[model samples]
Target chain A: MTEKELLKQLNKLRTINAEADFKAANRQMLLAQITQGEEVKSLGYLAQLNIFMSRLFQPYAIAIMIALFFVASGAYGLTISRQAKPGDSLYLAKKLSERTKMLVAFDEKTKARLNLEFASNRVLEMNLLKQDNNQSSAKETLKNDFKNEINQAKSRLAKNQPEAKSDKTNDFKTAGSVKDNDHIDVAVPDKKVATTTNQGAGIGEVLEEAQKLFDTGAYDQAADKLNEANKLVK
Target chain B: MTAKPQTDKSSNKSDRNIFLSLKKYQDKEAFMQAYDLYFDQIFRFIFFKIGNREDAQDLASATFLRCWGYVQEGKLKSEQEYKSLRSFLYKIARNLTIDYYRQARPQASLEEAEEIAADFNPGLIEAETSIEVEFITAKLKELKSEYRNILVLKYVNDLTISEIAPILGKTKGNVRVTLYRALEALKNLTRDHDGEGITKTIK
Candidate 1:
């Protein structure tokens, strides 16, 4: 016979399939055996969970998950640190977090604004310490730190004055938005208000003048006005 | 003429995924699907090997049970072994068939008759079987076990050489050469029996 005819005849043997009744019966028996075997040696939920965890989270994956948890909790703690006083444990973290925020600011104006807000916060912290009867030395140190932060804010604003002057419409827009600092209302009025009429100016009015000076590119003068507003809080 | 089986990439991928589900999760559904898919082919394969229907049926069932036992014990090693479920099942059936022979005849050493069983039990060929089938099966029995197995896997099971290689633990080139030789041997056997009207009956 030719190979083709032989191959055709060989292919015909494929018809020797398993009988239907035998297949169905054997399948049922096999499944029952498997089910019994599974039950006999079944791992409990905890063991299965362990296996699942082991498969899903390799060493690197577990490490990544732990790192993400710390980051998330740290963020939550830092938010609470916003209220931290100078003597509190989270106080340093609060300062470092603020510094990080300032460094990440996209523009000099935003950085200067953040520094000014930080300077106000330091003065606010000092007042709270005084009320709590904290040491005089701590207040003096806070006063020095506040002065340094105000100076940095002034320098940053002065550095960006040329850009501010070029964008006249944006400068006016900045002056108009000065009232957005409604949240910065903790600054105490200066006791010298009875002696100097200008001292009678509210912190809001002093900030408004600062914004006007900024619009005119007199950034150092604007910074002096904000510094005056901060000193009055003490 | 070459008996080449078509390779379906998608189907192979799906089968591998099902096997993985069985391996990792011990998924009964996946195992059932595998059993349904290969039960007939495995039965036919065992039937060809042992030449007995009742024994073939029992061994085929045992094959799946043994496979599940391996899965439960995580005995199947390496990624390549898991790639083709059909090849893996055939490999198991082939080994079991050898063991069946070794047990059936303790007098003849398994090493001596590992490929060819001493007695093929031609009477056990299915009742109501056609003359062509009986003739081919009897002729196939005369050939050595290697030739018979290669022919059955290639033609009866429609497995490609690539699929057959891993099951037989032979190289693709070796399987191809053996397959050629097997077909030649079968053709020679038919030509020698031409006068007996066997070739005429087949035609």
Candidate 2:
């Protein structure tokens, strides 16, 4: 038969009368399942059977799978929770736990020299204070104080620099140069380093603060806190 | 229907079967009424699709599975809203056949291609018998699955492109392209096998 002729015949046969048997089967099954008010297991029962079979044949495998699942899920859940929770601020803590490694790739020795040079004025002011207490004007006193702090900060920065490479657990002193005064953006080591440095203490603390900020709807503040946390171990 | 504004004669036949199915499913009398109305036309349609008594038996069995679902369940309302129950179930049968192929896999070989091309005679098959079905079914087997499927769904099953798109998981445009391509391929394969003369007589 040609395609056209065959198609004509097929169309003629497309809507045959319904058979008695099919109606009985469909009606019985649908009624049986729907009245139960629960799932009709007959459809997907075969799939569930396979899962059970694996458990019986591989007891140890199942046990290990369960244990691993718990451990992995617990760890993932904790990590997600930490990500979800806003951390307590570095500003709030006042004492930052920054690793020293970030001091590397320093702009050049010139940056350090300039830093020290700028810091000297404060040192000179403190020295003058001992010679003639009131003789140093307020501006001079302020400069002197600032200079001493700058020098002290520089020295602290330099000594910590060597250890920063070998050990990533050094304190906030590594975040040298008062980064916009009072508030310092400390660099935390990578999670690898942070785990070694002070992972137990800091992660819990930082996570808690950031979580608090997030909960309060202070998204900007929460972000700032997280960045500071990242910097602490950078 | 209060006033079926459908002016198309095709829609009238289409509309009537739909109405019958709805009435039959709605009430037992309606069920018997619809069966009497469409039984001959629908049987002929299915017998043509499978092209053999036994498989047509199976296809017809499946067709009623849908029809019964329509009746007792009240899922489909009045047939006039639709083209007709026959069109609706034919759509189902086409899908069911494709799904049967996917499920059956290696079991469902393209049977027509095995026949010899030489001494091929479209005229040899008797005009009103299973002989013609075997020949055409053989030629049908020669077409690619996509073309064969569309040809079956559109021409063999008498479905609109609109009705077939959702069932085949395709756009209407895609269905048209596939249908035309399938027809062309079937035509070419027929020409190659039976000569261009065969294509003219069969079509």
Candidate 3:
């Protein structure tokens, strides 16, 4: 073949491209690297954290993490303990799990809600003991534990009410000071007063009704009241 | 003598602008543009060097990554290193293929080249069922690396001698000479195999 023909033949190799899929994937990867590097350069720690969180929350990464957590935390034990009765072997585990949940609840309202939940659970155990014809002493002890939980829950919910009002009052005071100093419209707290007053009254009444039902030994009614209190708090 | 391919001046200017933006401002969009400009040619160059699709893909990726690294570092010895991103990428790809051979396996001798020629299939190019193309590619594998590279760069990638010179670390005159000789060698290879009907088909 002449060199012209040879050249023409060689030119056919142009059709031999990198696979389109590979080209696109590599482009995405390289561009991602470029952007990630620039982000780190410009945004520093926050960019690094963003990248870390994004990778951490990728589907496969999240799945692996959830699997690792379930394995390490012995979630099967927790699951079985959720069904344990007051005198069962896993009862302590159940209590420990409940305590752990409360400890990590991150806010007082959530903790109060947990207290109400555990109190309702204690009443259920007491009722179960009565159905099983357990000793009166055991039922009495469970009833006392239920009363303590309900009292703690009521006090917690009640404490949140005044704190909410006080916080609104402080916010209004700060807004007044800011308005006086800067002549700005610092009226943010004016919006919170009505909402807080309505919510505080609603939660206070629910907690009071729950307490009255408990005192009357209306356990089922108290459970329903506790739920209403929980909803109000939420 | 084989005439050099015409260089598109506007495209070259565009590539230079993108490279500068990446270097000066660390612009990601510019880097992506650079990637678009060079990925196919770089991938083809590395594919010619390594004779396999997968390793060629990896080395091609590495070539672009290393180029980005240099842009990020902003500490090259001279501005000539930044003169042509295309040449810079080719150099990186060539070095990566060399490293790949050194670390992964022995260099492909003439005998292994034959084995590669026989075993290699451009199966990924689904519509490319031409036997002549396959035969030419196999013959391309049989040539020395320098001759093969010069021919592929000159003819296949349509790079000008001046553009190829920096990539191969050779003078423009040297690239011209090598490209001529490479074309002659390919002609002889095809001529010798005329019984296989390449000559008949061309005629």
TM-scores of all predicted structures: 0.51, 0.34, 0.49
Give the Cα error of residue B158 in candidate 1, in Å: 1.6
Q: Please, what are the lDDT tens digits per residue for candidate 1 over residues A1-234?
A: 666668778877877887776676455455444554233234458755554464343333443344334333444444445677877756654554454354335465576677777766765676567566547777777667766766676666556445434454454445456547664532333333322334323544666675566445454576577777666433
TM-score of chain A of each: 0.42, 0.18, 0.51
lDDT of each: 0.66, 0.42, 0.66
Error of 3 at A221 (Å): 44
lDDT of 2 by residue, B1-203 (tens): 01111133443343453355344424222233334334444444444343444344345445444555656576664443344555565555554444334333434443422111111232432345443355556676566555655666566445566656665568889987887677667666555444334445667
DockQ, Cα level, model 2: 0.06
lDDT of each residue in B1-203, candidate 3, tens digit only = 66546566655766655555555566444456567667889888877776677667767777777777787798422436435667777877776666555433346654454334334334443444366777788788777778888888878887767678887778889988888888888888888655336746664
Off by over 4 Å in 3: A37-234, B76-83, B105-129, B192-203
Model 2 misplacement above 4 A:
A1-234, B1-17, B20-52, B77-83, B94-133, B193-203
How many Å off is the CA of A178 in candidate 1?
99
Predicted model 3 interface RMSD: 15.9
Q: Compared with the true structure, what per-residue lDDT tens digits does model 1 show for residues B50-97?
A: 788877877787788778888889876444643377788898888777
lDDT of 3 by residue, A30-120 (tens): 5444444233233246643543364353434454344334333333343445566777755654554455345335456777889888987
Candidate number with the higher DockQ (2 or 3) = 3
